[model samples]
Target: MYRKMVLIRRFEEMAGKQYMQASIGGFCHLYIGQEAVAVGIISALRPDDYVMGTYREHGQILAVGSDPKAIMAELFGRETGISRGKGGSMHLFDRERNFMGGDGIVGGGLPIATGVGLAIRYRGGDQVCVCFFGDGAVNEGAFHEALNMAALWKLPVIFVCENNLYGMGTQVTRASAVPDLNRRVSGYGMESAHVDGMDLLAIRALSDDVVAECRAGRGPWFIEAKTYRYRGHSMADPATYRTKDEVEEWRVRDPISIYEKQLLGAGLITDEEIRGISAEIDAVVDESVKFAEESPFPQADALYDHVYASGE
Candidate 1:
């Protein structure tokens, strides 16, 4: 878990650097501070279970076992990318891995995740679908509609709201009528939990138990993970809406640092082991960047390849 978080941290750092260097195009949202939420939730998911997330999803894709090389390649707009470079940063799909995609539209993934849950029920399978979205999406009508349907049908879907306190530059209090997002879920008669997204262990334990319950056909559970982002909504904005002191306060509870300290105190890991993991992640991230750099961009003639037919 430490290694995975470190890898994602370093990956985002490198991606941000590359974006600043003008090597990568398009909007890029970093998952720097919210690594624990993605890793912990994904760790609880089964291989056959589905995972869906919002635009801030590089870590989510990686957590669900998408190759770093492929993800980086996609960001680089290279043909060998997970979506053949067309999906860019927001959309990453791997059918074999059961990762639906990281939706670019706010609250877009909710209905799709509910559909996946419906499919599992229709097939008489126990597979669960985990929908990850930001607090911003809670205001979107789709979030409420999807939850209502998921609850009414008892579809196996776990809705995870990663509440980072802001939607782009707008604060949650300024946007949401009910800042307590879990309460919104309760209106639909869905079970919900408010959680510490920074604490990986807490998320893992709760998600594990909830996932088990959902897989057993008792679900459409909701979890509001109170977390924060270390960076702005995108690389473009300076994040002037929040203060340095606020950022520093959250930094003290940096997921990786908190977990590392816990691991050390519990005798679960030595300092040297932690350092070794960091070194290994650095190498992997380096290789991933190189792989993306060496890869080719999509061909011009391939634009119409994956286009859907009219089905007439």
Candidate 2:
């Protein structure tokens, strides 16, 4: 869990740097402070389970076992990218891995995840579909509609909401009428709970239980992960809405640092081991950047190729 969390943190740090350097185009949302949410949830998932997420999905993709080199190449719009350079930061897909996509639309992934859950049941498979979205998305009609249908059908799906205090610029208190986002699926008659997103061990344990329940033909569940993002909603947003002190407060509970402290306190990892792991992750990130740099950008004619549907 510590290694997985660290890798995501370092990967996003490098991604942000690259975006500032003009290597990555399009809207880039850095999942800096919410490392544990992605690491914990994804690491607990089975290999064949389906996953879908919102625009802020880079970490989710990385944590789910996607190749860093290909992911970086996709961010760079290179032909060697996972989506063949067509989808940038907000859109990534890998059917082989069952990572459906990172939808750019706010609440778009909810219904799609429900459909995936339905499909799995239709095929008589026990695989669970995990849909990750932000606090802001739960208020959308699609979210309510999807959950209602999923609950009615008893679909094997889990709705994980990463509540990072604010939705873009508006705080949850100002945006949501309910405020307690854990109740998102309550009206739909689905089981739900709130979890400390910063605690990796707790998140992993709960996620494991959720997966098990869903795989056993139980109804859908919803999770309200109390997480926060250090960066703005997008690379463009300056995040002037929140105060400096508020940001610092959340920084102190940073998932990576908190997890590191736990590892140290438990005598599970030496200080030297932590440094070694950091160095290893840095090297991997450096290699990914190099791979993206050496890769070719898609040609203009290549655009026309994937544009039309081939009648199978």
Candidate 3:
């Protein structure tokens, strides 16, 4: 779990660098401080479980065990990308891994997640679908609709709201009539809870129970993970709306650092081992960049290939 968090942190850091260097084009959303939310929730899931996410989903895909090289290539618009470079950062998809792709639209994945749950029920499969979105998405009509449908049918879906307190520079208090997002689940008569997103172990323990319940035919749970993003909403965002002091306050409780301290305190891992892990992940991130840099762009002729279902 620690290693996964580090990998995502390092990967996002490098991705930010690549975006600034003009190597990675299109809208890039980095999941920096919110590593625990992805790692904790995903690490508890089975390999076959479906995982869906929002545009800021590099961390989620990584937690689902997609190759860093392919993801980096996608960001660079290379032909070897996970989505063949067409989806870029926002639309990463890995069917083999059951990562149902990231959506560019706010609350887009909610309805799809509901549909996935319905499919699971239809097929009589015990598989569960975990859909992740931001605090902003809760306001979308789709959010309410999807939750209502999932609850009505008792679908095996876990709706995870990664509440980072800002919907593109607007604070949650300013935007939401009721700032407590978990409470909104009451309207749909769905079970809900809150987790400290900075604490990975806590999130993982809660996820284990929730996922089991969902798989056991009691489902459509809502989890509001109280997380914070260290970076802006996207590469283009300056994030000047918030003061530096507020950012620093959250930084003091950084998910990675919090977990590192716990591990150290428990004597579960040594400082040397942590250093070794960091070095290894750093090399992996570096290699992903090299792969992206050396890879060729998608050819023009292949553009129309995946666009249509029929080979018209």
lDDT values, one for every candidate: 0.92, 0.90, 0.95
Q: What is the lDDT of residue 55 in candidate 1?
A: 92
How do the predictions measure up, each by TM-score?
0.98, 0.97, 0.99
lDDT per residue for candidate 3 within 195-291, as digits (tens), equals 9999999999999999999999999999999999999999999999999999999999999999999999999999999999999999999999999
Give the Cα-based TM-score of candidate 1 against the true structure: 0.98
Residue 68 in model 1: lDDT: 95
**Cα error, candidate 2, residue 155 (Å):** 0.4
Roughly what TM-score does model 3 have, to 2 decimal places? Answer: 0.99
Of the candidates shown, which would achieve the greatest lDDT relative to the real structure? Answer: 3
What shift in Å separates residue 106 of candidate 3 from its native position after superposition?
0.2
Runs with alpha carbons beyond 4 Å of true place in candidate 1? 309-312
Candidate 3: C-alpha lDDT: 0.95
Write the residue-wise lDDT of candidate 2 on 145-177 in tens digits. 999999999999999999998889999999888
lDDT of candidate 3 at residue 87, scale 0 to 100: 93
Question: lDDT of candidate 2 vs native?
Answer: 0.90
* RMSD list, candidates in order: 1.3, 1.2, 0.7
TM-score of predicted structure 2 = 0.97
* Number of backbone collisions per candidate: 0, 0, 0
